[model samples]
Target: MFKRLAKCIAFANIKGGTGKTTTCINIAGYLAKSGNKVLVVDFDPQANATSGLGIDGTTIEYSMYDAFLNQCQGYDGIPITKIVLETSVENIHLVPSSLNLGVASMLLQGTRDKTGILKRIIEPVKSFYDYILIDVPSDTGLFMLNSLRAAEQIVIPLDPSIFSLEALEYLKTYCRDIEEMSDHVINQITVVLNRAIISNSTQNSSGKPSPSEEIESRLKELPDPVFVVPQSLLIYRSQQEGLPISHYATNTGKIGKAYEAIATHLSGNSNVVTIPEREAEYAS
Candidate 1:
Protein backbone atom coordinates (compact mmCIF):
# COMPACT_ATOMS: atom_id res chain seq x y z
CA MET A 1 0.00 0.00 0.00
CA PHE A 2 3.03 2.28 -0.18
CA LYS A 3 2.82 5.20 -2.52
CA ARG A 4 4.55 4.78 -5.88
CA LEU A 5 7.76 6.54 -4.98
CA ALA A 6 10.65 4.30 -6.03
CA LYS A 7 12.02 0.79 -5.54
CA CYS A 8 13.42 1.73 -2.13
CA ILE A 9 14.51 -0.89 0.39
CA ALA A 10 15.61 -0.12 3.92
CA PHE A 11 17.94 -2.70 5.54
CA ALA A 12 17.23 -2.16 9.22
CA ASN A 13 17.74 -3.71 12.68
CA ILE A 14 18.55 -1.75 15.79
CA LYS A 15 21.38 -4.09 16.60
CA GLY A 16 25.04 -3.46 15.84
CA GLY A 17 27.46 -5.99 14.31
CA THR A 18 24.54 -8.02 12.94
CA GLY A 19 25.81 -7.93 9.34
CA LYS A 20 23.23 -5.37 8.23
CA THR A 21 25.68 -3.13 6.37
CA THR A 22 27.55 -6.10 4.91
CA THR A 23 24.33 -7.61 3.60
CA CYS A 24 23.25 -4.32 2.04
CA ILE A 25 26.59 -3.78 0.28
CA ASN A 26 26.96 -7.28 -1.17
CA ILE A 27 23.33 -7.49 -2.27
CA ALA A 28 23.71 -4.19 -4.06
CA GLY A 29 26.85 -5.53 -5.72
CA TYR A 30 25.19 -8.77 -6.87
CA LEU A 31 22.09 -6.99 -8.15
CA ALA A 32 24.30 -4.67 -10.15
CA LYS A 33 26.34 -7.61 -11.48
CA SER A 34 23.05 -9.07 -12.70
CA GLY A 35 22.72 -6.12 -15.13
CA ASN A 36 20.41 -3.96 -13.08
CA LYS A 37 21.36 -0.37 -12.33
CA VAL A 38 21.63 0.01 -8.54
CA LEU A 39 22.21 2.90 -6.18
CA VAL A 40 23.38 2.37 -2.61
CA VAL A 41 22.33 5.05 -0.18
CA ASP A 42 24.48 4.75 2.92
CA PHE A 43 22.25 6.66 5.31
CA ASP A 44 24.00 5.20 8.33
CA PRO A 45 26.01 7.82 10.18
CA GLN A 46 28.81 5.35 10.82
CA ALA A 47 29.70 5.37 7.09
CA ASN A 48 30.52 1.65 7.19
CA ALA A 49 28.76 1.02 3.87
CA THR A 50 30.77 3.73 2.15
CA SER A 51 34.12 2.36 3.28
CA GLY A 52 33.08 -1.25 2.80
CA LEU A 53 32.74 -0.67 -0.95
CA GLY A 54 36.36 0.62 -1.10
CA ILE A 55 35.29 4.24 -1.07
CA ASP A 56 37.23 6.23 1.51
CA GLY A 57 34.95 8.49 3.51
CA THR A 58 37.66 11.01 4.36
CA THR A 59 38.38 11.80 0.69
CA ILE A 60 34.75 12.17 -0.38
CA GLU A 61 33.83 15.58 -1.74
CA TYR A 62 30.11 15.18 -1.12
CA SER A 63 28.09 12.95 1.18
CA MET A 64 24.58 12.22 2.55
CA TYR A 65 25.19 14.83 5.22
CA ASP A 66 25.08 17.54 2.59
CA ALA A 67 21.92 16.12 1.01
CA PHE A 68 20.01 16.13 4.27
CA LEU A 69 21.22 19.60 5.22
CA ASN A 70 20.48 21.17 1.86
CA GLN A 71 17.34 19.33 0.87
CA CYS A 72 15.73 19.24 4.26
CA GLN A 73 16.98 22.32 6.09
CA GLY A 74 16.05 24.79 3.34
CA TYR A 75 19.63 25.60 2.39
CA ASP A 76 20.75 26.08 -1.21
CA GLY A 77 22.98 22.99 -1.20
CA ILE A 78 23.76 20.41 -3.83
CA PRO A 79 21.11 18.01 -5.08
CA ILE A 80 21.16 14.36 -4.14
CA THR A 81 22.30 13.52 -7.67
CA LYS A 82 25.42 15.60 -7.10
CA ILE A 83 26.37 13.35 -4.22
CA VAL A 84 25.97 10.06 -6.09
CA LEU A 85 29.31 8.50 -7.02
CA GLU A 86 30.35 5.47 -9.03
CA THR A 87 31.42 2.56 -6.83
CA SER A 88 33.98 -0.23 -7.28
CA VAL A 89 31.17 -2.54 -8.38
CA GLU A 90 29.89 -2.12 -11.91
CA ASN A 91 26.30 -1.04 -12.44
CA ILE A 92 26.29 0.18 -8.84
CA HIS A 93 26.56 3.71 -7.48
CA LEU A 94 26.61 5.25 -4.00
CA VAL A 95 25.52 8.25 -2.03
CA PRO A 96 28.40 8.01 0.43
CA SER A 97 28.21 8.91 4.11
CA SER A 98 30.48 11.01 6.28
CA LEU A 99 31.24 11.43 9.98
CA ASN A 100 29.19 14.63 9.94
CA LEU A 101 26.03 12.68 9.09
CA GLY A 102 24.87 12.46 12.71
CA VAL A 103 24.63 16.24 12.89
CA ALA A 104 21.86 16.33 10.27
CA SER A 105 19.51 14.47 12.58
CA MET A 106 19.95 17.15 15.22
CA LEU A 107 19.73 20.08 12.81
CA LEU A 108 16.42 18.91 11.38
CA GLN A 109 14.92 18.82 14.85
CA GLY A 110 11.64 20.79 15.18
CA THR A 111 11.36 21.04 11.39
CA ARG A 112 8.01 20.37 9.80
CA ASP A 113 7.68 17.12 7.89
CA LYS A 114 11.16 16.01 8.91
CA THR A 115 10.58 12.29 8.48
CA GLY A 116 9.64 12.78 4.82
CA ILE A 117 12.78 14.70 3.92
CA LEU A 118 14.59 11.62 2.62
CA LYS A 119 11.48 10.55 0.73
CA ARG A 120 11.22 13.87 -1.07
CA ILE A 121 14.94 13.97 -1.85
CA ILE A 122 14.79 10.54 -3.40
CA GLU A 123 11.48 11.04 -5.23
CA PRO A 124 13.12 13.17 -7.93
CA VAL A 125 15.47 10.35 -8.96
CA LYS A 126 13.20 7.31 -9.00
CA SER A 127 13.58 6.51 -12.68
CA PHE A 128 17.37 6.52 -12.65
CA TYR A 129 17.87 3.12 -11.08
CA ASP A 130 16.17 -0.28 -10.83
CA TYR A 131 16.60 -0.28 -7.07
CA ILE A 132 17.70 1.99 -4.23
CA LEU A 133 19.08 0.27 -1.15
CA ILE A 134 19.28 2.35 2.01
CA ASP A 135 21.53 1.37 4.95
CA VAL A 136 20.44 3.13 8.09
CA PRO A 137 21.85 3.24 11.63
CA SER A 138 21.29 0.48 14.17
CA ASP A 139 19.16 2.68 16.36
CA THR A 140 15.51 3.75 16.36
CA GLY A 141 16.24 7.41 15.90
CA LEU A 142 15.26 10.10 13.42
CA PHE A 143 17.66 8.79 10.77
CA MET A 144 16.25 5.29 10.97
CA LEU A 145 12.67 6.54 10.78
CA ASN A 146 13.39 8.75 7.75
CA SER A 147 14.92 5.92 5.73
CA LEU A 148 12.17 3.50 6.72
CA ARG A 149 9.62 6.10 5.72
CA ALA A 150 11.08 6.18 2.21
CA ALA A 151 11.39 2.44 1.75
CA GLU A 152 8.88 0.12 0.07
CA GLN A 153 10.45 -3.04 1.51
CA ILE A 154 12.34 -3.84 4.72
CA VAL A 155 15.23 -6.32 4.86
CA ILE A 156 16.22 -7.42 8.36
CA PRO A 157 19.75 -8.87 8.48
CA LEU A 158 19.59 -10.81 11.74
CA ASP A 159 22.34 -12.76 13.44
CA PRO A 160 21.36 -15.82 15.45
CA SER A 161 21.30 -14.70 19.07
CA ILE A 162 18.84 -14.24 21.89
CA PHE A 163 19.29 -10.47 21.73
CA SER A 164 18.70 -10.49 17.97
CA LEU A 165 15.42 -12.32 18.43
CA GLU A 166 14.30 -9.60 20.79
CA ALA A 167 15.38 -6.97 18.27
CA LEU A 168 13.25 -8.56 15.55
CA GLU A 169 10.15 -8.37 17.69
CA TYR A 170 10.87 -4.71 18.35
CA LEU A 171 11.48 -4.14 14.62
CA LYS A 172 8.09 -5.60 13.70
CA THR A 173 6.41 -3.05 15.91
CA TYR A 174 8.63 -0.31 14.51
CA CYS A 175 7.67 -1.19 10.94
CA ARG A 176 4.00 -0.82 11.86
CA ASP A 177 4.77 2.58 13.31
CA ILE A 178 6.51 3.51 10.06
CA GLU A 179 3.49 2.42 8.04
CA GLU A 180 1.24 4.62 10.10
CA MET A 181 3.62 7.54 9.88
CA SER A 182 4.24 7.23 6.15
CA ASP A 183 0.58 6.65 5.34
CA HIS A 184 1.36 3.40 3.49
CA VAL A 185 2.12 -0.17 4.34
CA ILE A 186 5.57 -1.64 3.73
CA ASN A 187 4.64 -4.17 1.08
CA GLN A 188 7.33 -6.83 1.60
CA ILE A 189 9.72 -7.91 4.33
CA THR A 190 12.48 -10.51 3.98
CA VAL A 191 14.76 -11.86 6.74
CA VAL A 192 18.32 -12.99 6.17
CA LEU A 193 19.39 -15.20 9.09
CA ASN A 194 23.10 -14.44 9.03
CA ARG A 195 25.91 -16.62 10.36
CA ALA A 196 23.62 -19.62 10.89
CA ILE A 197 25.07 -22.83 12.24
CA ILE A 198 22.76 -25.79 11.53
CA SER A 199 24.96 -28.71 12.67
CA ASN A 200 23.87 -28.52 16.29
CA SER A 201 20.75 -30.68 16.03
CA THR A 202 21.45 -32.92 19.03
CA GLN A 203 19.72 -32.15 22.32
CA ASN A 204 21.19 -32.38 25.84
CA SER A 205 20.35 -34.95 28.49
CA SER A 206 17.65 -32.65 29.83
CA GLY A 207 16.12 -32.44 26.31
CA LYS A 208 16.88 -28.73 25.96
CA PRO A 209 17.34 -27.91 22.29
CA SER A 210 20.63 -26.72 20.83
CA PRO A 211 20.96 -23.01 20.16
CA SER A 212 20.54 -23.49 16.44
CA GLU A 213 17.44 -25.68 16.88
CA GLU A 214 15.86 -23.23 19.25
CA ILE A 215 16.56 -20.28 16.96
CA GLU A 216 15.14 -22.10 13.95
CA SER A 217 12.03 -23.02 15.92
CA ARG A 218 11.52 -19.38 16.88
CA LEU A 219 12.14 -18.22 13.31
CA LYS A 220 9.38 -20.51 12.00
CA GLU A 221 6.82 -18.43 13.85
CA LEU A 222 7.59 -15.32 11.79
CA PRO A 223 5.29 -14.76 8.80
CA ASP A 224 8.14 -13.98 6.41
CA PRO A 225 10.38 -16.59 4.81
CA VAL A 226 13.92 -16.84 6.25
CA PHE A 227 17.16 -17.23 4.28
CA VAL A 228 20.10 -18.78 6.12
CA VAL A 229 23.72 -17.59 5.74
CA PRO A 230 26.21 -19.97 7.29
CA GLN A 231 29.08 -18.93 9.51
CA SER A 232 32.23 -18.34 7.41
CA LEU A 233 35.60 -16.72 7.97
CA LEU A 234 35.74 -15.61 4.33
CA ILE A 235 33.13 -13.00 5.15
CA TYR A 236 35.59 -11.30 7.42
CA ARG A 237 38.41 -11.66 4.90
CA SER A 238 36.31 -10.05 2.18
CA GLN A 239 35.46 -7.16 4.46
CA GLN A 240 39.09 -6.67 5.40
CA GLU A 241 39.97 -6.46 1.73
CA GLY A 242 37.09 -4.07 1.10
CA LEU A 243 35.35 -6.33 -1.39
CA PRO A 244 31.90 -7.84 -1.71
CA ILE A 245 31.65 -11.58 -1.05
CA SER A 246 30.62 -12.32 -4.65
CA HIS A 247 33.60 -10.44 -5.98
CA TYR A 248 36.01 -11.90 -3.44
CA ALA A 249 34.73 -15.48 -3.68
CA THR A 250 33.73 -15.31 -7.38
CA ASN A 251 30.29 -16.70 -6.43
CA THR A 252 31.70 -20.23 -6.07
CA GLY A 253 32.08 -21.07 -2.35
CA LYS A 254 29.40 -21.84 0.21
CA ILE A 255 29.25 -18.39 1.83
CA GLY A 256 29.30 -16.70 -1.54
CA LYS A 257 26.49 -18.88 -2.88
CA ALA A 258 24.41 -18.28 0.22
CA TYR A 259 24.55 -14.53 -0.39
CA GLU A 260 23.92 -15.11 -4.08
CA ALA A 261 20.79 -17.02 -3.14
CA ILE A 262 19.72 -13.96 -1.22
CA ALA A 263 20.55 -11.84 -4.23
CA THR A 264 18.38 -14.18 -6.31
CA HIS A 265 15.46 -13.75 -3.97
CA LEU A 266 15.87 -9.98 -3.97
CA SER A 267 16.05 -9.94 -7.76
CA GLY A 268 12.71 -11.69 -8.10
CA ASN A 269 9.24 -10.25 -7.60
CA SER A 270 8.89 -12.03 -4.27
CA ASN A 271 11.32 -9.59 -2.66
CA VAL A 272 9.87 -6.47 -4.25
CA VAL A 273 6.57 -4.91 -3.35
CA THR A 274 3.95 -4.70 -6.08
CA ILE A 275 2.49 -1.26 -6.57
CA PRO A 276 -0.24 -1.20 -9.19
CA GLU A 277 -0.21 2.48 -10.06
CA ARG A 278 3.54 2.52 -10.38
CA GLU A 279 3.43 -0.39 -12.78
CA ALA A 280 0.72 1.39 -14.76
CA GLU A 281 2.76 4.53 -14.87
CA TYR A 282 5.80 2.60 -16.08
CA ALA A 283 3.65 0.85 -18.69
CA SER A 284 2.65 4.17 -20.16
Candidate 2:
Protein backbone atom coordinates (compact mmCIF):
# COMPACT_ATOMS: atom_id res chain seq x y z
CA MET A 1 0.00 0.00 0.00
CA PHE A 2 1.19 3.48 -0.76
CA LYS A 3 1.88 5.62 2.24
CA ARG A 4 -0.43 8.57 2.95
CA LEU A 5 2.19 11.29 2.74
CA ALA A 6 0.57 14.04 0.64
CA LYS A 7 0.59 17.52 2.17
CA CYS A 8 -3.07 18.55 2.07
CA ILE A 9 -3.02 22.32 1.65
CA ALA A 10 -5.90 24.79 1.36
CA PHE A 11 -5.79 28.02 -0.63
CA ALA A 12 -8.30 30.13 1.22
CA ASN A 13 -9.45 33.70 1.74
CA ILE A 14 -12.70 35.11 3.12
CA LYS A 15 -13.21 37.56 0.26
CA GLY A 16 -13.90 37.14 -3.42
CA GLY A 17 -11.39 38.54 -5.96
CA THR A 18 -8.57 37.82 -3.52
CA GLY A 19 -7.01 35.34 -5.98
CA LYS A 20 -7.83 32.23 -3.95
CA THR A 21 -8.56 30.13 -7.03
CA THR A 22 -5.80 31.77 -9.06
CA THR A 23 -3.13 31.04 -6.47
CA CYS A 24 -4.33 27.47 -6.04
CA ILE A 25 -4.37 26.77 -9.78
CA ASN A 26 -0.94 28.29 -10.47
CA ILE A 27 0.61 26.55 -7.50
CA ALA A 28 -0.83 23.23 -8.59
CA GLY A 29 0.44 23.77 -12.14
CA TYR A 30 3.94 24.64 -10.95
CA LEU A 31 4.08 21.68 -8.57
CA ALA A 32 2.96 19.24 -11.24
CA LYS A 33 5.55 20.66 -13.62
CA SER A 34 8.20 19.81 -11.01
CA GLY A 35 7.26 16.07 -11.09
CA ASN A 36 5.33 16.28 -7.83
CA LYS A 37 1.95 14.65 -8.33
CA VAL A 38 -0.89 16.96 -7.32
CA LEU A 39 -4.60 16.62 -6.67
CA VAL A 40 -6.77 19.73 -6.61
CA VAL A 41 -10.01 19.43 -4.68
CA ASP A 42 -12.51 22.10 -5.67
CA PHE A 43 -14.22 22.41 -2.33
CA ASP A 44 -15.81 25.71 -3.33
CA PRO A 45 -19.37 25.60 -4.55
CA GLN A 46 -18.53 27.96 -7.43
CA ALA A 47 -16.24 25.26 -8.90
CA ASN A 48 -13.92 27.75 -10.59
CA ALA A 49 -10.91 25.51 -10.04
CA THR A 50 -12.66 22.66 -11.80
CA SER A 51 -13.28 24.56 -15.03
CA GLY A 52 -10.06 26.52 -14.67
CA LEU A 53 -8.32 23.16 -15.17
CA GLY A 54 -10.23 22.71 -18.46
CA ILE A 55 -12.73 20.17 -17.07
CA ASP A 56 -16.14 20.67 -18.62
CA GLY A 57 -18.76 21.02 -15.90
CA THR A 58 -21.45 19.34 -17.98
CA THR A 59 -19.35 16.19 -18.40
CA ILE A 60 -18.67 15.54 -14.73
CA GLU A 61 -20.56 12.43 -13.66
CA TYR A 62 -19.33 12.52 -10.10
CA SER A 63 -17.84 15.25 -7.94
CA MET A 64 -16.93 16.22 -4.35
CA TYR A 65 -20.56 17.10 -3.71
CA ASP A 66 -21.73 13.61 -4.63
CA ALA A 67 -19.26 12.13 -2.18
CA PHE A 68 -20.56 14.28 0.67
CA LEU A 69 -24.23 13.90 -0.28
CA ASN A 70 -23.91 10.13 -0.46
CA GLN A 71 -22.12 9.85 2.87
CA CYS A 72 -24.62 12.11 4.59
CA GLN A 73 -27.60 10.29 3.12
CA GLY A 74 -26.23 6.93 4.34
CA TYR A 75 -25.72 5.62 0.82
CA ASP A 76 -22.46 4.10 -0.36
CA GLY A 77 -20.42 7.10 -1.37
CA ILE A 78 -18.44 6.82 -4.57
CA PRO A 79 -14.74 6.19 -4.07
CA ILE A 80 -12.54 9.21 -4.68
CA THR A 81 -10.57 7.24 -7.24
CA LYS A 82 -13.68 7.00 -9.35
CA ILE A 83 -14.43 10.69 -9.03
CA VAL A 84 -10.92 11.90 -9.75
CA LEU A 85 -10.40 13.20 -13.31
CA GLU A 86 -7.36 14.03 -15.40
CA THR A 87 -6.79 17.74 -15.95
CA SER A 88 -5.08 19.62 -18.79
CA VAL A 89 -1.86 19.50 -16.83
CA GLU A 90 0.03 16.21 -16.66
CA ASN A 91 0.74 14.75 -13.21
CA ILE A 92 -2.22 16.68 -11.83
CA HIS A 93 -5.70 15.35 -11.10
CA LEU A 94 -8.84 17.04 -9.84
CA VAL A 95 -11.87 16.28 -7.70
CA PRO A 96 -14.21 18.66 -9.44
CA SER A 97 -16.94 20.57 -7.64
CA SER A 98 -20.47 20.99 -8.95
CA LEU A 99 -23.53 23.15 -8.46
CA ASN A 100 -24.96 20.53 -6.11
CA LEU A 101 -22.05 21.23 -3.75
CA GLY A 102 -24.14 23.81 -1.92
CA VAL A 103 -26.88 21.21 -1.51
CA ALA A 104 -24.42 18.83 0.11
CA SER A 105 -23.74 21.41 2.79
CA MET A 106 -27.44 21.43 3.62
CA LEU A 107 -27.34 17.65 4.14
CA LEU A 108 -24.56 18.08 6.69
CA GLN A 109 -26.68 20.44 8.79
CA GLY A 110 -27.43 17.86 11.51
CA THR A 111 -24.76 15.25 10.91
CA ARG A 112 -22.66 13.94 13.77
CA ASP A 113 -19.42 14.75 11.98
CA LYS A 114 -20.42 17.49 9.61
CA THR A 115 -17.07 19.21 9.44
CA GLY A 116 -15.15 15.95 9.20
CA ILE A 117 -17.09 14.71 6.17
CA LEU A 118 -14.64 16.19 3.65
CA LYS A 119 -11.66 14.93 5.61
CA ARG A 120 -13.09 11.42 5.50
CA ILE A 121 -13.64 11.62 1.75
CA ILE A 122 -10.11 12.91 1.11
CA GLU A 123 -8.33 10.41 3.41
CA PRO A 124 -8.73 7.55 0.97
CA VAL A 125 -6.92 9.41 -1.84
CA LYS A 126 -4.05 10.86 0.17
CA SER A 127 -1.57 8.22 -0.88
CA PHE A 128 -1.88 9.00 -4.60
CA TYR A 129 -0.50 12.54 -4.46
CA ASP A 130 2.42 14.52 -3.09
CA TYR A 131 0.26 17.59 -2.65
CA ILE A 132 -3.53 17.87 -2.33
CA LEU A 133 -4.64 21.47 -2.73
CA ILE A 134 -8.17 22.36 -1.64
CA ASP A 135 -9.72 25.50 -3.15
CA VAL A 136 -12.15 26.61 -0.49
CA PRO A 137 -14.73 29.40 -0.58
CA SER A 138 -14.74 32.76 1.17
CA ASP A 139 -16.72 31.98 4.26
CA THR A 140 -16.65 30.59 7.81
CA GLY A 141 -19.31 28.01 7.12
CA LEU A 142 -19.11 24.23 6.89
CA PHE A 143 -17.16 24.30 3.62
CA MET A 144 -14.30 26.37 5.02
CA LEU A 145 -14.32 24.46 8.32
CA ASN A 146 -14.19 21.09 6.59
CA SER A 147 -11.18 22.08 4.48
CA LEU A 148 -9.42 23.63 7.46
CA ARG A 149 -9.89 20.50 9.53
CA ALA A 150 -8.62 18.31 6.71
CA ALA A 151 -5.58 20.36 5.70
CA GLU A 152 -2.07 20.30 7.18
CA GLN A 153 -1.08 23.54 5.46
CA ILE A 154 -2.99 26.75 4.69
CA VAL A 155 -2.28 29.42 2.07
CA ILE A 156 -4.14 32.68 2.47
CA PRO A 157 -4.31 34.62 -0.81
CA LEU A 158 -5.11 38.30 -0.62
CA ASP A 159 -5.32 41.24 -3.03
CA PRO A 160 -4.98 44.95 -2.37
CA SER A 161 -8.15 45.79 -0.50
CA ILE A 162 -9.30 46.73 2.98
CA PHE A 163 -11.61 43.72 2.96
CA SER A 164 -8.67 41.44 2.37
CA LEU A 165 -6.90 42.75 5.43
CA GLU A 166 -10.04 42.20 7.50
CA ALA A 167 -10.29 38.67 6.18
CA LEU A 168 -6.70 37.93 7.15
CA GLU A 169 -7.23 39.02 10.72
CA TYR A 170 -10.45 37.08 10.91
CA LEU A 171 -8.80 33.94 9.58
CA LYS A 172 -5.96 34.19 12.09
CA THR A 173 -8.42 34.22 14.97
CA TYR A 174 -10.64 31.64 13.33
CA CYS A 175 -7.77 29.21 12.85
CA ARG A 176 -6.74 29.64 16.46
CA ASP A 177 -10.27 28.93 17.64
CA ILE A 178 -10.48 25.83 15.50
CA GLU A 179 -7.15 24.61 16.88
CA GLU A 180 -8.43 24.96 20.41
CA MET A 181 -11.68 23.23 19.53
CA SER A 182 -9.94 20.37 17.77
CA ASP A 183 -6.46 18.99 18.36
CA HIS A 184 -5.51 19.61 14.72
CA VAL A 185 -2.75 22.17 14.64
CA ILE A 186 -2.34 24.24 11.46
CA ASN A 187 1.30 23.20 11.27
CA GLN A 188 2.13 25.52 8.35
CA ILE A 189 0.81 28.84 7.10
CA THR A 190 1.78 30.89 4.05
CA VAL A 191 0.45 34.27 3.01
CA VAL A 192 0.39 35.08 -0.69
CA LEU A 193 -0.05 38.74 -1.67
CA ASN A 194 -1.90 38.72 -4.96
CA ARG A 195 -2.90 41.33 -7.59
CA ALA A 196 -0.29 43.76 -6.33
CA ILE A 197 0.02 46.94 -8.36
CA ILE A 198 3.78 47.10 -8.77
CA SER A 199 4.45 50.15 -10.95
CA ASN A 200 7.38 52.52 -10.47
CA SER A 201 6.26 55.15 -12.97
CA THR A 202 2.64 55.35 -11.92
CA GLN A 203 2.02 57.88 -9.17
CA ASN A 204 -0.74 57.64 -6.56
CA SER A 205 -2.82 60.80 -6.69
CA SER A 206 -3.80 60.46 -3.00
CA GLY A 207 -0.19 60.78 -1.86
CA LYS A 208 -0.46 57.71 0.38
CA PRO A 209 0.65 54.13 0.07
CA SER A 210 -1.61 52.12 -2.21
CA PRO A 211 -3.83 49.40 -0.81
CA SER A 212 -1.40 46.75 -2.02
CA GLU A 213 1.51 48.50 -0.38
CA GLU A 214 -0.40 48.89 2.88
CA ILE A 215 -1.36 45.23 2.94
CA GLU A 216 2.21 44.25 2.11
CA SER A 217 3.44 46.29 5.05
CA ARG A 218 0.91 44.74 7.38
CA LEU A 219 1.72 41.18 6.24
CA LYS A 220 5.42 41.82 6.87
CA GLU A 221 4.61 42.07 10.55
CA LEU A 222 3.52 38.44 10.58
CA PRO A 223 6.04 35.64 10.96
CA ASP A 224 4.76 33.57 8.03
CA PRO A 225 6.48 33.76 4.63
CA VAL A 226 4.61 36.12 2.27
CA PHE A 227 4.72 35.90 -1.54
CA VAL A 228 3.70 38.59 -4.00
CA VAL A 229 1.84 37.96 -7.28
CA PRO A 230 1.63 41.10 -9.37
CA GLN A 231 -1.49 42.23 -11.19
CA SER A 232 -1.19 41.22 -14.83
CA LEU A 233 -3.51 41.03 -17.79
CA LEU A 234 -2.10 37.61 -18.57
CA ILE A 235 -3.74 36.23 -15.45
CA TYR A 236 -7.20 37.04 -16.75
CA ARG A 237 -6.36 35.89 -20.24
CA SER A 238 -5.07 32.60 -18.91
CA GLN A 239 -8.19 32.11 -16.81
CA GLN A 240 -10.36 32.73 -19.83
CA GLU A 241 -8.54 29.88 -21.53
CA GLY A 242 -9.15 27.67 -18.49
CA LEU A 243 -5.42 27.28 -17.92
CA PRO A 244 -3.11 28.24 -15.09
CA ILE A 245 -0.72 31.16 -15.29
CA SER A 246 2.21 28.77 -15.19
CA HIS A 247 0.89 26.83 -18.16
CA TYR A 248 -0.36 29.78 -20.20
CA ALA A 249 2.32 32.20 -19.07
CA THR A 250 5.15 30.43 -20.89
CA ASN A 251 7.11 33.69 -21.16
CA THR A 252 9.53 34.97 -18.57
CA GLY A 253 7.60 37.38 -16.33
CA LYS A 254 7.17 38.51 -12.75
CA ILE A 255 3.95 36.57 -12.18
CA GLY A 256 5.31 33.20 -13.28
CA LYS A 257 8.58 33.61 -11.37
CA ALA A 258 6.73 34.43 -8.13
CA TYR A 259 4.48 31.37 -8.42
CA GLU A 260 7.44 29.13 -9.19
CA ALA A 261 9.16 30.30 -6.04
CA ILE A 262 6.05 29.52 -4.04
CA ALA A 263 5.80 25.98 -5.43
CA THR A 264 9.49 25.40 -4.62
CA HIS A 265 9.15 26.74 -1.10
CA LEU A 266 6.03 24.69 -0.42
CA SER A 267 7.84 21.56 -1.60
CA GLY A 268 10.47 22.18 1.08
CA ASN A 269 13.05 22.95 -1.59
CA SER A 270 14.35 26.36 -0.52
CA ASN A 271 13.63 29.65 1.20
CA VAL A 272 13.26 31.27 -2.17
CA VAL A 273 11.31 34.53 -2.89
CA THR A 274 9.36 36.48 -0.34
CA ILE A 275 7.58 39.86 -0.31
CA PRO A 276 10.65 42.01 -0.74
CA GLU A 277 10.57 45.34 1.09
CA ARG A 278 10.57 47.33 -2.13
CA GLU A 279 8.16 48.89 -4.56
CA ALA A 280 7.91 46.80 -7.71
CA GLU A 281 5.29 46.86 -10.45
CA TYR A 282 4.09 44.17 -12.84
CA ALA A 283 3.86 45.87 -16.25
CA SER A 284 0.46 45.21 -17.70
The lDDT per prediction is 0.78, 0.84
TM-score of each: 0.87, 0.92
Choose the strongest candidate by lDDT.
Answer: 2
Candidate 2 matches the true fold with a TM-score of 0.92
| Stretches > 4 Å off in candidate 1 | 1-6, 200-209, 269-284
C-alpha lDDT (0 to 100) for residue 93 of candidate 2: 96
For model 2, state the Cα shift of residue 2 in Å. 7.4
Worst 10 residues of 1 by lDDT: 273-282
**lDDT per residue (tens digit) for residues 1-284 in model 2:** 64757999999877777889989999999999888899999998799999999899999999987778756855556778789999888888999999878877666544677777788888888888999999999888888888888988899998888788889888878788778878888888899988887534356766677777888889888888888888889878988998887778669388888888889888887775656633343333
- Model 1 lDDT per residue over 181-220, tens place: 6696788788877776645235256556657556767877
Native-referenced Cα lDDT, model 2: 0.84
- Itemize residue pairs with steric clashes in candidate 1: none
* Poorly placed runs, candidate 2 (over 4 Å): 1-4, 205-208, 277-284
